[model samples]
Target: MSGETTNETWEEIVVRVLKANEVSLVTYVPDNVLSRLIRLIEADPFFTVVAPAREEEAVAIVTGAYMAGKRGIALMQTSGFATIVNALASLACPFQIPLLLMISERGTLGEFQQGQAIVCRTMRPVLQSLGIEHFAIQERAHVEFVVDGMVRQAFATQAPAALILSPLLTKRAA
Candidate 1:
């Protein structure tokens, strides 16, 4: 599929997936690719969106939300993933707190920033090193399948699962 037809707006897709999973809490650091999604969740009364002071803080908050019997997802950029590595390894790994992480895949094709490229190239290996389960969303057609499967698996395994969003799978607002 062409990029235009394949990359649906993030808000429409994410709202559907989250509602299907019955997720009630969302914690995230601001991400440009995910701004529309954040806004959608913010406007929904049934969902609670928490903007944490730091990436790790978002991890901790989601962990707590899970323990409180609320399903939660965290949104952040690839670099923010690096910042929360320690927390994912220490807290989420051992405690088996299932988290749906919506991550912007940086440093890939068409990326302008050098730093984003470096980290984007290495992000998967980093997640692998930490043993976190993850899936890349490269096209809109894969969003529902990837998101639903990962979310279910994360909760079933009681571990963190990630849906990595690449620019190829998204489009900038016109």
Candidate 2:
């Protein structure tokens, strides 16, 4: 109770925080690691979930939704995050859209795919280069804090923010 989500799963905490923040639009490119989170968001009537063909398309969808006076979040895998750089740089950043990205971290220790690892390495650098605020949620206790704080910051400042869901947090590291 009172912002303490110690008993809930990370996905549940994410959905709770998102709802609490009034993020009504959920835009994402389907990702296996994020399936549970997406499903939870979809089941909730408060959210308008949209799956676009590509990660960049998801970003665009969120941007358009924000323009129309609705808050949105984009969910994707780390590799998919690599595909949205142009859209984020062009449409989201320059236009002052508060694009909230929830990326399922891939590539790194215990990872099997070389491409995922390659892209994972580049994600943080790209975010930093673009001056997009980002944070990784690796602990259950930290989930609500990071997600909620990032969401608040992005919308308050009209800037982009990312919440990277680490394999450790999702318990699907591979």
Candidate 3:
């Protein structure tokens, strides 16, 4: 697993983790880094992939899915995270609904977009301020651990939890 030739694609790892967690509903705002993973989820009969027009819409949909007794996860980019702060604070937080957020980390090290950088830099702090628990995954090997741990915490606490995947871990294949 350590060799260069043995690295698993993020889509493969994400599919495995979501299945293992028995996640039935997925809501996402489109993101290139997460596109493959989203496709995999859509192809699987065990998962229902919902693409919303906006990040907050995805949040609201996932929140409703959780209420209906389904396990849910939301996938979005860093800028999307910025857009859903209010929903996270008002709907998700107060309800203590278990939600798994898979966020693509932007605005860091090699980021070129100024607006993305601003939101990316503040994403974690924003989650912290909302009292949302989260973890960042920067390698393929760390994906399962981070995803599993966050899912467990979110379910156990009946609260929203997030796992941020850095660009280093989700880089598109050359």
Per-candidate TM equals 0.90, 0.95, 0.91
lDDT of 3 by residue, 1-174 (tens): 223424567677777777887888899988887888888888999998888799888888888888888888999999999888989888899888887888988788788889887878789889999999888887776776777778877898898998888877877343
Off-target runs (Cα >4 Å) in candidate 2 are 172-174
**Residue range with the least summed lDDT across 10 consecutive positions in model 3:** 1-10
Question: All models: lDDT?
Answer: 0.83, 0.88, 0.83
How many angstroms is residue 83 displaced in model 2 relative to the true structure, after the best TM-score fit?
0.6
* Model 3 spans > 4 angstroms off: 1-7, 172-174
Ranking by TM-score: 2, 3, 1
Residue 73, model 3: lDDT of 90
Error of 3 at 31 (Å): 0.9
lDDT of 2 by residue, 3-59 (tens): 666678888888888888999999888888889888898889999998888999899
RMSD vs true structure, all candidates: 3.7, 1.8, 2.9
Model 1 Cα RMSD, Å?
3.7
Q: Which stretches of candidate 1 lie over 4 Å from their true place?
A: 1-8, 172-174
